[model samples]
Target: MVNETPQVMTIAGTDSSGGAGMTADLNTFAAHGIYGANVVVSITAQNTQGVRQVQMITPDMVMAQLKAVADDLAIRAVKTGMLGDADTVHTVAKALQQFDFGPLILDPVMVAKGGAQLLSDAAVEAVRTALMPLATLITPNIPEAEVLTGMTIQTPDEIMAAADKLHAFGTQNILIKGGHGDAPVVMDYVRLTSGDHFWMKTTRFDTQRTHGTGDTISAAITAQLGLGLDLKSAIIAGKAYVDATIRDGILVGHGYGPLNHLAVVTAQNQPEVYDDI
Candidate 1:
């Protein structure tokens, strides 16, 4: 019998703690019953407490990894996490342009949950200029969205405005995650290229185990997309999946713990979707 599993790729860094980065992305793909592939862009020695030291992979090696994966695996969807610097970002962008590695889910992973900056200022510009246009979907947290759009996002209107600014960057879809806000309920705003948008609201669990929430969600979306789900459906499923992971918390490390990737999201954890702005 031929191997028939849907394959997805994650181009990101390594988190030694197994909480965030490529680890989380791969775990998410497995949980969603999808085959996972990776292109290591950076390596970090860290745990749930915090990131200690980081070593970025060379651009040539990054390109080599991309070619190796694209040459073999039938990658249906791909997502990017921490690209480290401007050079790596440009390299990844060029690779995406070169290969038909399926839809690109660009996760603008700027800072670690423990307050460590994962992306450089020059890298931010590189992503905005080079990667954004190639992204099928861009997932950015509130802080990341603010940084990318250069606007202070404090209200729902501001979030939509930021999404518009991000959409102008040429991405077909934008998901502005509201997890950084101090609200009882987290509202993630989505803007599609077809002039359709909505807000996905879920109860904010009072826990600190959101270490890999962003990666987990984006990976879930990629998995669904690889499985042939439409973009809107993939986004909705991703929100539900992450909500389950967060709600079913697991105790691993001291500081911000990692999400329970094994937790199965039931229909009860479905996010309340708002079709209006």
Candidate 2:
């Protein structure tokens, strides 16, 4: 029998810019040879400069879209992006709860790279309390992690602590991204439910084309999981894929541009994937 290609789903918003959200998730899924299905929860009148306006889809519509996909696709893994509000968040969690979509990789998208609030303030708690517990892996950058744990993350040790708190939030895995800070190296902390944890570091590239980094990485992880990789392997591979994307930055719109997802990179071109254990 021939091996079947894995199918993945991205439940997120839309970026007209084609740099982030569903666009980037689908791009990353394609790059990994995984079929991608999407459920658009919001639409932003946005480009590289910034998000000018956001119109969230209704909860019923979002659920309907989800139902349409689940009714047909054999979605092996899933990732969640920008759920617009508390109600939408609840709706997504409720619907997703009714099915087994394999591993749940959650990207708690709060603010955009241009400093626009993609998620409402009230929904922060909703995401943490309502949906986060259902996650197999939660990918949160520095600010999002701080908001979730209500703790400051300056020291590397604090990053570990934040991962602990997020793990307590009920996810079996946690990837606390440190790319938001200005440091010589981008440090990412990963902790699994089995008490296994490690810090991965790569030389940070200073550039404006890092707009869709979070979506890309989380989608990569989900795709890998769909293809049968374990959580640790998926996380490591996700970081490597994101590092390549960021390193090969491309010029898109005026402001912070999008990553060159089509950049040609073999395993030889990527950096050392993990740091001291």
Query: How many pairs of residues in model 2 come into backbone collision?
Result: 0
Residues 69-99 of candidate 2 have per-residue lDDT tens digits of 8887788999999887999999989987998
Error of 2 at 45 (Å): 0.5
- Winner by lDDT: 1
TM-score of each: 0.98, 0.95
**Model 1 agreement with the true structure over 1-277: per-residue lDDT tens digits:** 3447789999999999999999999999999999999999999999999999999999999999999987878899999999989999999999999999999999999999999999999999999999999999999998999899999999888988898889888888999898886789998999998888999989888998899999999999999999999999999999999999999989999999999999989987899999874
Worst 10 residues of 2 by lDDT: 268-277
For model 2, the stretches where C-alpha displacement exceeds 4 angstroms are: 1-4, 268-277
For candidate 1, the lDDT comes to 0.94
